[model samples]
Target: MFHAIPYILSLIAAICAALPVLLLEPSRTQSAGEIRLVHLLVTWNPAITAILLALGLVLAARSFFRLENRAARAALLIPVAVLGLGTYAARVNVFEKMFAPLPDPGFVAAHQADFLSPHDLVLGVSLGDESKAYPVGIVAYHHIVNDRLSDEPFVVTY
Candidate 1:
């Protein structure tokens, strides 16, 4: 029925907006299929969300002008709100906000790094005569480190 089109479109748009967050934001295990789905969704979410929002808005407006029941008109508006939310979600990369890159990382000699145990894993970078070690524990959280060694710039990612 014509009345159901907006509801279906809204539901799909909401899922497209939420699927990436649900799969990525948590520190839980994901199956291979789920990970693949997340990658596909993240890659195409912007286009898919934009098209759905546009279509849903146009259809909802048409239905709103024709519908007689106030309740039905109000229900049709829910799709607009959901599509707006989808647009926002598509624009923002929550993971980037959560795990920002370390821009001004400090370094210390291995002997002075008492926080690291003898067996702690590290990501080591060597540039000419200069060298630095980044603990994997820290790199795992921030995911990227921007540093300079002897006036040369490099980035390390985990």
Candidate 2:
């Protein structure tokens, strides 16, 4: 039972790292309960994951000394790698990485926009003499578009 500490900690750390990302990913359909869980995990993840990884590292180090066989020591590598990956996942904002912002937005004249059907949704913005229409389909994946209109910088989000 005592020897299982590292594996247990690694398993839990992996779950902690993956739970929020899985529930909150943009493409997935999220329910209220799942969103609530993601909120809870986001609040507690850093502290909890740090503690688990630290404890697991210390325990694995101690196990290396107690275990004499070469293969058993090598087996500890799996848990160490798991803990490392979990820590990385917990630290990074994978959603932002996956859904990149539209850096250079293209525009077409309304009359020339043959791609848009009559009923398609769009976000229309007007600044002074400038007018632009962003299709909802494009905005949904990128989430944000940064552009300049009438020489003033602004952002659009969906």
Candidate 3:
């Protein structure tokens, strides 16, 4: 039982860390009750994950000294490795890193009919005498556009 405790705790921590990110989309569209539950999970999972990882590390360190077989020791190391990696991933915000926001994107001028399909969506902004259009297709991928209009800096995001 003691030998398995670290693995169990590490697994639980990893799953908890991953759950909020995985459920983000569904949570947004869920009923109020479900959304509240997911909101609580997303808000608290990080701290919970950290605590679980710390406890798992302690247990793994304690168990390491008691293990006799080489293979058993090697197997015991797996959960510790996973806990370390998971902690790093959680700290780094791996999902956001994977789809990092665009930085200072540029724009091109072209006839609307040349590039845009008639049915496509776009975001339009007007500031004083300046007007700009951002195709939804482009902004959907990068999630942000930085630009200046009327000498004022602003960002557009979807």
Candidate 4:
């Protein structure tokens, strides 16, 4: 019961948001239409709630002014801004967790998109002029089999 409070609150909010579309919107009051509205409402309700909450909290916190008005305002503004940004950024983290199966920006940004296999070899040479030999399979796996970081045009093993 205690741990379920947040989940319960979220469910309630989702239902409340869908209620208008499911009930008041006469066209969408049908079964399939209601289902679509419920899906949209549930998906979007949490985000809306979070944004409103962050804005409200920031406003409330910033309203607590004091003697050094300018300094106090600046201090309040800085934290509120950070908090608001962080609240929104947390959603990005959530999305990463949800859809990590696909290659996301973070994976490409890290430059670890190339997954190497034992059978693969690398047959590489010097960067510009000086020549050198490398394992063909290993380098091929690194370049051909693995996904590009969305920037590099090409990578040749030999």
Candidate 5:
């Protein structure tokens, strides 16, 4: 029951998303590969994650009512507690996501190099649309150029 309910809920969500993907495309103002707002809203990973999490939570709560043994409740509570904490974390993060858009997938895929600690290395490079937060005022005592960030495969000159 725990597993089956989540799958059913996800199926319903997919159907909901599909309606917008098909029906809403004609109404969009932009042309080309522009991402539609409906696309962004309905297909956002967080939205789907929230749906799945809610369904799982409901299932968990349902199980709690059916449980008999005290030990069974204790075992179930561990996962339930973790899910609760996870849901809380996801909720807090979801609002933050809408403001700052996800980086372009092409930019991310184009340059998929692993990030290294830049402060230690006087010379380091980061390519693609991947972002690495480097400590300010801690960069190597050398030349640094922040303007080269938009040149295709961006190279942070430092």
Candidate 6:
């Protein structure tokens, strides 16, 4: 039972660390009332993760000294390694992976009738005689699009 302490602590630490990355975006889409609850959790995730990591380390050190068998000592390394890797992953900016900016996106010209939906939202940009429209659906996913209009470079972001 004593040997399980480190692993349990590490598991909790990893979950706390991962919650913000996994839930932040989904929370944004929630209703305003529920968003406040989610915001609280997201805001405190970092502090919670830090505390859990500290506790896990302390418990891991205590367990290491208490275990006498060589095999049991080696088993403790598993949780230590998991905690290390989980901490590294938790520190990464997950948005950098999700929202990849588009560069030199291809466009096709069309008549007004080509867009069947009258309610479609688009981001329209005009530079002198050149004009472009980017659909909001695509922009919402990638967040950023790089394009050139009349040889002038521009970036559009949601």
Which candidate tops lDDT?
Answer: 1
**Residue range 1-158, candidate 5, lDDT tens digits:** 55345445544454444443454445556543345654564446356646666866787677667778677655665555544444444334332343343233222332453453433333334557644433332233222334344365442323
Q: How do the residues 25-46 of candidate 1 rate in per-residue lDDT, one tens digit apiece?
A: 5779889999999999988999
Q: After superposition on all CA atoms, how large is the RMSD of candidate 1?
A: 4.0
Each prediction's whole-model lDDT (CA): 0.88, 0.87, 0.76, 0.44, 0.47, 0.74
TM-score of each: 0.73, 0.70, 0.69, 0.27, 0.32, 0.55
Model 5, TM vs. native: 0.32
> Each prediction's Cα RMSD?
4.0, 4.1, 3.9, 14.7, 14.0, 6.2
* Number of the top TM-score candidate: 1
Candidate 5: which stretches are off by over 4 Å? Answer: 1-43, 88-158
Once fitted onto the true fold, the runs of candidate 2 whose alpha carbons sit more than 4 angstroms away are 24-29, 103-122, 127-140, 146-155
Worst 10 residues of 3 by lDDT: 19-28
Error at 96, model 5, angstroms = 11
Expressed as tens digits, the lDDT of each residue in 1-158 for candidate 6 is 87798899778767766666555655356567556755665566556666666777888788889988888888877778777766666666677776675755878785753753668788998998999988898888888887889999888889
lDDT at position 19, candidate 4: 58
Q: Which stretches of candidate 3 lie over 4 Å from their true place?
A: 25-29, 92-100, 108-122, 146-158
Q: Residue 108 CA error for candidate 6 (Å)?
A: 19
Backbone steric clashes in candidate 4, count: 14
Clashes of 2: 0
Model 4, runs deviating above 4 Å: 1-68, 94-118, 121-158
Q: Per-residue lDDT for 46 in model 5?
A: 50
Error of 2 at 147 (Å): 6.7
